[model samples]
Target: MSRLGSFAGDKMKTRGRKVRGSAYLAVPFVLLAFVATASTAFAATESTSKTAIFARVTWKVVKPGDAVDFDLQITNGARLGEDPVTYDLKILDLPEGWQEKFFYQGEQVKSLTLKPGESLTVTVEILTAPNSSTGIYQLTFMAYSWMAEYASTQSLSVELREPIREINLVATFPGIVAQVGETVQHSIVIQNRGESGESLRLSALAPEGWSTRFITQDKSEVSSVYLAAGQSITLALETETTDNATPGGYTLTVRASSEDGVVNALMELMIALREKENVSDFDFVSRFPEVTAEAGKSLTYPITLRNLSANDQEIILSVVTAPEKWKTAFKSGDTEVTRITLNPSQSLDLIFQATPPSEVSVGDYSIVVEAESGSTVKQVVFKAKVVGLYKLDVQPSTLYTSVTAGNPLTTTVKVTNSGLSPVTTLSIQVTAPSGWDVSFSPARALSLDPKDSYSFTVTVVPPSNTVAGDYLISVKALSDQYVSDEVQLRVTVEAPTSWALAGVVVAVIAVSLLIFIFKKFSRR
Candidate 1:
């Protein structure tokens, strides 16, 4: 070789040698490329990469309280075969107040054997600093190895929480007997049920037509006083039912969430409205025949009392003032039907034997009955008199009651109210002997007046197959006001099988004719 050309050959050989820095730079890139290839081993690269970063980490976070969690991640980034390999962190990428305790596995990694898809887990604390920011932050992470600089880093995110103040409010309101729409001024027993004294916060939710205010023992401003656990404060909630407010029950919920993650709870308020007495359904039963009485005697009205509200109610049951010269005996049905005291949705019947004023005719008299239940009262009015004349005169002057089985024994029941007043809503029924069916034909609603008589058909049917025998028939009549005394239904049922003899004779004739024909034919 020429002397100069020999020198150039030496230079070219020297230039061809790989620089240590170039090797360093290629490390991360190779590692990254390997990882990329392994990730998509079957995938082709869309473009070539000039640089890459990779991470070797198993990131984790810890829970400090019920409200928060902390996490950390660690990774390394290096240039391929580079000297003094180092990394830089961007503050803008991290949370404003979050403390990023950068954990570096190493400044430089010198491994070429790393194939694609290889990774290691390391710890890097992304902790909430004492002075952590109040908003979300994103941090980028990258890692690298010798052969190639592995690329990529996950973005870590965090939520920053603001310091809050603790508040506890409690109240003890008094029981009240309020009329409908009545205003209740209530004082509540309040307490700071929390830890660490604080500038206690006090507030009220929507209270109906009500106002709230705190009353400190020392009259401290409710806004600024530091309240410790077990400490107490008083507040008043004033509200009144509207003039048109519905009478019933209501609830109010007041809450307290503690600052500094202290204790939290709430108070509940229950309000009730009292109502006036009103009448609902009212009915009556008589104490005469079957609930019977003499023609000259008076009847008792058994009235029932009922409560229809959710609250326990007390009702005052009473009879109105009696007219001069009147006689009556009254008793509560408690001893008769039910012995237990009645509660809500409960009722009791009372029987009153009210006689017409001495000079009053033996007729229905308007009697007023009143019941007072708690703050509720009701009055009911009904009429009663000398029970019907019951001199039920059967038409034709006699109840000729003879009925064959399968026949209707119709008789005119002239129920005359010989007494003075009109009888309304008469429900009549006729009873019969066992095995004998009885019914009132032309079934209907009926009403009768003083000395007035009603005519209705009473029907009795004896079974068509009734055996020859005598059966006593009976009848009963019930009205809204009275039940008639059971009347004797003198009925005789005869053996109605007389047609059996006729059927037998016909059968005998038919047999003889058949026999005669057979004999004649044989002879021929």
Candidate 2:
């Protein structure tokens, strides 16, 4: 019985050892499972923390009365398969009386929702008061997500500066001339040289009995204009004088002002007035009473005619006296007319053309133009001084020649005066191929009278290495008062004599060598 009990105790001990071994093996598995679970929880916490707000530009400089904008982005870092998050937007520490608005996709919104791994862009616009003091301002913007229990905040700074408000008024023409009972127009430009735009009221102060108004490019009359920052506009200022207006210098003041009177611009313009002359029964006026031109060229005189009578009159026009063999006519804009009808206070512009004969002498000639209306007659005298014509001709002895390379060529050219005028200080110029030398004898002529001719000797030499080809040489005659057309001469160049002789010698030597070789080989 003692032996059986000892055996049972040993069996109990073996069973206990087996159970302890199983427990040791299971410990590592449990540890690995716990580690994996904790790691997953940490990853989730890290992803959620990435949900935040970001701003591209948090600081800016702006002028008072200006609007400032900040670009912002809201991101959701929730993992895929996660629910969307909604955020409430708010602005803190903003100045009093300042206006602020939040916009998403160009629409004002107080809150926005973003999907997992999604981002949304938003804008905040702030406007300061016109009279705001110049200083640095700070403001905070927040986006709160209740579901995530997170608040993302961004601080923005803005420096406000003094406002610039300037307007410039300028008159294109500060002075004008006009007669009594007449209206004149001037151009003026309005420019805004400020940081902001404004609506300006325009006014003009003129003398008594004179009216003024501004006209736009579209011809619409306007008393006010709107100008944008750094922009300008042009307008016409028209002034009308009364019938009884006196003849004197008058000053006009033009003004442009804003509604609050903070911005103003003033410009002054001067107007000169002259007295009206009494009207005559018949009037004839000529701006040009005398003219000088070549004998073959025509002369023109501009004449103005007015009839002050209270009735319509039939007028006759004619050239009563002129130089011999000269043709004169009255033209009203390319149409020939000898008679015309004029109403009271009406005027007509006439072109009187006088053409002299080609052989007319160089002297002053008198012309009388007459206009008759019943018993009324008006006459105007004009003078014409005729200068002789000018013409030049150039002639060459030959049009073509041939020469060997490195040889000289000789030719003769004649310059003639074909017209009535005398040509003086006449010279010759030659243009030839490259690497060629040219010269002229008796380089200049003192004078060449009408129908007179002068001869010049021309020499040309080509370079030794000149190519054997056909080339051209141009000769022209020039005077202080005239230039003649260019005359072209063609020249042919031949190879040098030595080159031909050497070629022949080479041929002979080749033939002799072939004969010797044939005779020597036959002996074998």
Candidate 3:
């Protein structure tokens, strides 16, 4: 060995061994690779350390075409003094016509800002389309960070349930306007919103004793009907109120039922009477509408006149019409006046006096009282019944008479007029039993004054074939101006006088002859 090699070896043994040139270059490359790996790990850690944002409930059940709410909570998770962060709320991949809104404290918000370690709660409302299919749908609620331009998403599961049976009833006129004792008809539209057909029965509930009917579009009456899916039908609802029904508002709850469910709709009916003020601006009322009086007597009526107009009015009182020979006058406050001034909603009482003629007939009479305002006139009719002051009677002197068969008998009938007025055209009427003929001697009618009387001869005849018995006869005196008077009598029928006398003679002769024969036999 050389002296230099030996010295280098000693140095190598004393110190560490020397590196090659390529190995030195590879050291810098290894350090660069380590730095790149550490950077990648830091970025992965940052990405995983996201803010806490999640829904209160992961899934919910809802009905199609219905609104649902999702409660969401976000917690800052950042260290204190970190920069304020802004996030935008949105719904990702939403179906067309679907609505999604973010609400903060009952108000909708588009974006939210939070400081470090701060927390926020928001409500998310989602509305599905009317025609949406039924199934489980996954929807994403995204919160995009403005600083990082990164989106954080939470999943919400919505389960939609389709309706089995649904019906909607609509009316063009929900309220019916009518008068008392009137029938009102209205059209209603029925729409089936379910996916299947339904058989629905229609019925109405209202005040007791009210009549209601359902008529279809073709005017046919039906108790129940069939409807197709998504079909619409129009029907008329007729309501008839009683004549004595009061005036007010009536509520009707109409219901349509199927095997699945029942649906109800409300209808308001407004009923009012034909008010006297509606015809005219004034009204006339009487305490008593009808009166009974004797013939030739005067009658007085009290009436109240009301001003129903919005403004004051001057009413002219007059008599529209009355019976012939009747004089009518109106008096107010001890003075005969035909004019009155009344304030709005004010009323005045007046007297209506009428004098009837002395020769007036006994019957019903009507008087009309009229009130006239500017361009308006109102009239009221009052009824008066007149009764007679006298009476008529028919009497018979002898009620019964004995008559032979095939013979006639006559009886006297007295007809008297007891009324204060004369009775004219008095005629006689007779009614007898079977197999008997009855008539009046004077077949014509006669007139009788008050307190006067007339006698009539009534003849009765029994047929030959009639058995000996008692029969009833009725006699009546009829008058044109008064009631008829009636009287009843009885007739007894007997055998002929000639036959009865012959029987008595034959009995006497037989007894005498028997005595003579007995004496002759004893003498022999």
Candidate 4:
């Protein structure tokens, strides 16, 4: 019995040893797996911390059928000298029928590479469907780096709304003068101030028996025009007046309408008509009956003379009435003439010159000119208005000055109003050589009466390194109405006193040394 018990005990001991051996072998595998998991987790954390994604605007409000762009930057915050990492880009949770694309440097891209401590910019363009409903849509953009095993995501939202539609119509000249059997032309501008392009039909409503048409600058007639957003076009409206049209005022309506008639613009124009003058044996006309001239100046008027008589006739021209001390003359091709002969149905061009006195007051004067041929007589009235002249004269106290380098030189300048009117808002300006400084004591003046003058103190400083030479400086007086002639001043730059003294000392030393050398050699 003892022997049998011993055998059983030995078998139990063997089984216990095998169990312990199996446990010891499994402990190494478990520890190795734990260490591997910890290392992997550390690597993932390190990589994620070194990468980032950023977007300036993550939310925006947009209109239906509009494209939205989100600018994003992918940054690798890892230490420099590390290898570049390539990131794969993707869009998540995008609605169906909506298109998405990524662009880098204007080219479509699916992936981008960024060096350590460097960043790359990319654009995510999202195009919404034309018929998209008004609501808020959210989209996610993700970037994954295969080398670093890291990922970053950015969320963006867009609120779609209805678009605004608008149109503008403008008339350059809303009033026009026309004679019977004459075609009157008017200019109109159309603009589309909307978020999309549109097709607009142009039409005009005129009085009965009048024809109207819309034509472009190239003379091409167009019933409809296409205008893009913020686009403008100029069109001409031509209207024909009837031969027997009564003398009255009429209103014409101009309109521009979109394709759907939802957007429209309207403008009203006024047309005035008068009776045509009867035919006569002689005709005299002046295009400009009134003219504005400056005091102490001469003005000329162009006149047309036609002889409708059946025979050759001699016409006499003369000024019947004019302002006292004012001179008037009629010239044909630079030759003074008092009478001219013209054949039947012949025309002659004449120039009428009028000069106002220097001391003429500011007012309007009427002058009557007459032309007579046998029994037929024609007269024209001209109005001339004299306006005040604006002139400025800039004078300096001294035209020339001398200055040493690195020193300031001050001079007085006078500004005079040599005009017939007062000068206001006057200021003085000084232009000097480069690296020089200039300043004025009183920078601006409120007003200067006629023949009055104002004095200004100008200080100029030259740079320390300026070479000894001559430089030109200019000063001028300016006002809101006119600018005076530039007054030039010559500035002579000389060496500093210390430098001159030093040069003298050097010369004396050299002369003394030469004398000593000569005496010593003579004695030898």
lDDT of each: 0.49, 0.82, 0.75, 0.83
The C-alpha local distance difference test score for the whole of candidate 1 amounts to: 0.49
Put down candidate 4 lDDT per residue, 1-62, tens digits, no spaces: 24323322342233111112346566556546644643453345344557788999998767
* Tens-digit lDDT track of model 1 for 432-473: 656767777557447666666667777677878876566765
C-alpha TM-scores of all predictions: 0.29, 0.44, 0.31, 0.49
Q: What TM-score number comes out for model 1? A: 0.29
Stretches of candidate 2 exceeding 4 Å from the true structure: 1-65, 69-136, 139-179, 184-195, 203-210, 216-222, 230-236, 245-296, 301-304, 308-349, 354-391, 396-411, 419-440, 443-452, 459-524
Residue 515 displacement (Å), model 2: 36
**Which whole-number lDDT from 0 to 100 does residue 424 have in model 3?**
76
Query: How would you order the candidates by lDDT, starting with the best?
Result: 4, 2, 3, 1
Residue-level lDDT for 301 in candidate 2: 93
Better of 3 and 4 by lDDT: 4
Winning candidate number (lDDT): 4
**Residues 220-310, candidate 3, lDDT per residue (tens digit)?**
9887778898998999888887767777777777778886555433444443444222447888789976888876677878899998888
| C-alpha positional error of residue 7 in candidate 4 after TM-score superposition, expressed in Å | 63
Which pairs clash in the backbone of model 4?
none
Which runs of model 1 end up more than 4 angstroms from their true locations? 1-133, 137-158, 163-408, 414-425, 431-439, 446-453, 461-465, 478-488, 494-524
lDDT of 2 by residue, 438-522 (tens): 9989989988887889999999998878889899999988887788899999999888899879989999999999999999999
Query: Residue 457 deviation, candidate 3, in Å?
Result: 12
TM-score (C-alpha, index-matched) for candidate 3: 0.31
